[model samples]
Target: MNMLDYIDWRGDLTFEQDGFNEVDNLVFSELAYTDMRDIVPEDGSRALTVAQVYGEYKAAGIDQSLMMNDPLPVLEKAAQSPRFKDITVKWYVDKIDTEQHLQFAAVTFIISDKLAYVAFRGTDNTIVGWREDFNISFLSETPGQTEAVAYVNRIAKLTDCKLIVGGHSKGGNFAVYACAFCDKDISEKRVIKIYTNDGPGFMNEVAESENYLSILSKTIKISPDSSPVGLFFLSKAERKVIKSDSKGFMQHNPYKWHVLGAEFESADARTDPFINMTISSWLNTMTDSNKKILVDYIFDSLEASGVTSFNELADNKWNSFNSIFKALTKIDPNDKTDIASSIKKLIASGKDVVISEKQKNAEIKKAEKNKVDNEKQE
Candidate 1:
């Protein structure tokens, strides 16, 4: 079954939903153990509530190690079930932190015939929530090295585990971080391929670490054509990037990522030099000032008008969009009614405009050619 299907049918300690005949019951049982009864009403019908479940574990006085480590047995049991029928299957759940936030990662294992797969899910706030409150600038916190990371290390130690890791957004980032910081013995055991579907990267301090260097050989970073989270600065030891089709802000969503046919049909699925150059150019031009101004305007618009989301801001009678633009431009958020007109004039004047795609490619090609010529001259 697909990842979405697995999530949909996931109920309290069970998978009672239909169209799940092919999956093993033991797998469902193991998943069921992740349930928290208080999360859903007494109805007991909602999908697993991750934070609530984790809280229950905390209240029960389960030591972090036992709480985090217990998932291994559940997964191992599921793998041993007859339904796997000689297929290589494993289950693992772990917690990891980048020192800023605690993250619980649920990883599914399916290894058979040399093909290994790991599907991960990110818990916590959603991007839409962040976008609405977009004034936060860059993420200040990294997932801490709490019990979560230790748990992840335990799973990574599994012998004979090959590579195949996938996660949406933050989960993708966690998967990469785990693979990067794993103990050498565990690191050598698995991690052949990593699929970071539109996940954000760590700050330069974390991304360029010695631990990160070890796994740079096998990494695939994919981003939507016009992703917001994927637009931050990253320094990779090597280049292995994949491009997807979902342009504009829609690319941040996995549903959109999957729309590209088998997960890449609706997406461009290209690693074109031109695309890379265009992105680099924009990154170069979009300075911290631009980010701060835009984010500050978002904050002002939200605060001044008591608006919660973009939709609410749009619905408010304050001409919020223009107000935000004016705030960003430092002109006047509550100026004349010609907000759009003023913005058009600013663009025409080339004040805060980002570099164009064509210009970006030209610059990249010129740099490459210059490097080649310099080497020859030397």
Candidate 2:
């Protein structure tokens, strides 16, 4: 059963009875995607119960066109569940600055009297959000990352409660970043754990920092067997591979993640080596400046289409494509050429890696066969 089923089966049990498990962690992480900015206070001075947020959501109904995934079902489930019904939610903050290509959202869940979970919202379907995500490969910290660290520090100072920070997708990246770089004294004392569920990694500078090393043991990184984002950059923290029902990019969806009882079904290793290698090699080819330029140019082209969200782009496909095509014509010829050449090089690198791996496997087989033949001769 998946998380929804787990919630139904174990809903009645309190934290005291079941204790906080990985299933609960994932449920909270996914719930981070819920848009709670309207219902909860920004300063977090006022506390709203889970039931209240669920009621507000039901009254408002759903808007499927929004960039974020629908959180209504998860809200309803949480409201019904005794485990989460009385949880106090506050400090809801959602920011989307198209000019800066930034999308950052987060909320705090006070699960117990002394325990709180800070969840960072991942990249929504907004073109800006996706652009900010790509910026991570080049920028040391995006605006979202900076805001996340401040948010955590604010919450930590407000309450002495033990903190668990987590997020799914890009949000997961924020969670780790906040924990790694926040005030060392506060984080080292109050932050108990950090969870990154299928989130991308930071650039080498951040990953190799002394701050990251200090909290590496407290961090938990989980990726599906076919993850592309989670395997981005180098991860120095403990990693876990979970089974997913979906394939390719769809596996990145938290709903497709498989769970058995209280925990996710674990995989021995990542299932898609070719994808892993291809992405790694492509990223290796681009310098930080190149990545920054590519991300800016791509997002600028998307914006030129006059579409903010992926939904809008998909709905008006012909117009969006035409607009982007027109915008491409306005770009510097050298930049356009460089972009095309880079893509070709990336594709070639992937092909080369595949061929190299195949050749290495063949050599190993031949060597094994020769050893067996010599043994027979003896």
Candidate 3:
């Protein structure tokens, strides 16, 4: 069973009776993608119940199915369910800035007077959103992450209620960042738990910082056992690996994640992190300047192709491919040459990293064998 099914089974119980579980964390995290612009107040002066929000959503012709991997059907059911129907949502913020290379959205679910969940929306259909995700490797803080800290601090300031920060994917990265860097009063006092549901990790610099370490005890990182996104830039910290109904990367979808009653179905462990580690090591090999050039070139190629949303790649595949191929003619020759050179260097760097890792592993294995042989002889 997944989140939608879990709602069918357990949606009747109130937070008072059941308390906020990881399942609840994900439900709210997923719903943060809902475009609440005018229906949900940005000022937090007023709020609307999930049912009422659904009505407004319908009236406004808001179709969330346009967004990538978004689950609007779940929201429809959530509106009808007893547990989530009356939950108030407020302080919705969605920002997309091409100049800043940003895509960020968040909404606060006021569960009760004493408790609230601040859920950040993850990567959407926007190219800018994906660009910000890539920026995570080279930049200390992506624009979305910076905004997240401010949003969390602002929400935490407005109420005395304890806050639970959560997000799926890029939003998960934001949730961790906001909780880690929020005001001392809010981080140490108001924020109770932070959940990053299959969210990618940060650069080693940010991951190793004191601010991030301070909230380690309060952080809950959960991922599908076969996760492709969450495993990227792999953080060595413990994560609760959950079983998924889908195979491979598609399991990144929260709805496909299996739920066993109130909790996710557990896996023995995550799938091997070898591929993820190699990608991380490859990125680490590049200087920040080189990383920026590659990041910009990739996104620039998408923009040159006139692709605005990722949905276009799926909905109109042949046309999108044709456009992408045609876009190469429009690129400046110098930029193309630069990108090609970067790729050549990347191939060389990747080979060295893999060879070094294999040799290190072989040494460890040889040492272990020698120790075992000596012990057996004795």
Candidate 4:
């Protein structure tokens, strides 16, 4: 069973009954992805209770199609639960800038009178959101992270309650950034835990910062066994690998995560060494500037297609592919060559890791065969 099932089973139980578990973390993290713009007050100076949001949502007769598809069901389920129905949700913020390649969203949930969870929205379907994600690899601070820090500080000042910061994917990265770099007084005194679910790590410089180290112990990082995004860059936090029903990169979806009882089903370790190796090798080979250039060109090409969201681009796959191909043709020859070469190197790295693993397995099989032969001879 996954988070939705868990909620149905335990919906009647309050935090006083079951206490907050990892399953609740996943629920809150997933809830962050909901588009709360309409439900939230324009000034965001006041908080809205979850029951109030649900009432408003139903009153407006807003279709599920208008909401983010994955989180819509989760939100509906959470709103139905007595445990979470009365939670006060506020400080909703969503910002996007195509020119700056920035996308950021966050909301605060006052789970109890004394406890609050600040859930940062992860990378959305927008091309700009994906671009900002790529920028994390090279830039010291992306616009999303900057805004996240400010948001946390603002929320902290507005309330004296303990804060739990968290997000899934890019949102997770923002949670970590806000927890680490927000006002030290607030982080030290009020912030309790930071949760990052399948979130990518920061650049080496940021990872080594004093701010990061200060709150490192309170950080809890969870990734699916076959995670690609979570394994990107350098992570000093020990990961709690969880089992997933989905294969390959599709495992990045939190809905695919397996849960039993009040916690996620755990995996002993990550399952995709080849993918991890290929990404690590490719990232190591490219300079920060070159990585930025390739990412920029790729997304710029997508923008040329006149599609803003991934769903739009994906719905018209052929046209999107053609637009990307045409845009590639328009790029400088040097950049084209570099991008091609980088892709080739990534492919080679994957091939090498796969072959190495196969050889190792073969050797193990041969050794087992020889041992059996020796036993027979004896």
Best by lDDT: 3
Q: List runs of model 3 lying over 4 Å from the truth.
A: 234-236, 272-281, 315-378
Give the C-alpha miss distance for residue 130 in model 3, angstroms.
0.3
- Candidate 4: misplaced stretches above 4 Å? 61-69, 273-278, 330-337, 343-378
Cα misplacement distance, residue 140 of candidate 2 (Å): 0.5
- Residue 202, candidate 1: alpha-carbon lDDT: 60
TM value for model 4: 0.86
Show pairs that collide, candidate 3.
none
RMSD of 1: 17.3
RMSD of each: 17.3, 12.9, 13.6, 11.5
For model 4, how does the per-residue alpha-carbon lDDT over 1-378 read when each residue is reduced to its tens digit? Answer: 988898899989887676777778878888877767788863567677776777777687765442232576677888889888888888788899998788999988888878889999888778798889888989989988999999999998887789999999998999999999999998899999999999999999999999998988999999998878798877788799999987566678788899989888998775587564567655766789778876776678779888787656545656866766676567677766656766555435434433443454466579879999999999
Better of 1 and 2 by lDDT: 2
TM-score of each predicted structure versus truth: 0.45, 0.87, 0.84, 0.86
Sort every candidate by lDDT, greatest first. 3, 4, 2, 1
Where does candidate 1 stray beyond 4 Å?
1-104, 112-116, 123-141, 144-148, 157-160, 235-246, 258-378
lDDT of 1 at 265: 30
lDDT of 3 at 41: 79
> What local lDDT does model 3 show for residue 131?
88
- What C-alpha lDDT does candidate 2 achieve relative to the native structure? 0.79
Model 2 lDDT tens row, 1-378: 788888998999998887888788888887777777677879877788888888886677644324344566677898999999889888899999988778999999998878899999998878888889878888888999999999999999887789999999998899999998899887799999899998898889998989888888999998888867788776787889998887655577687789888889998675576465556555766778667666666578779878887666656656765665566567677666556555555435434433443454466579879999999999
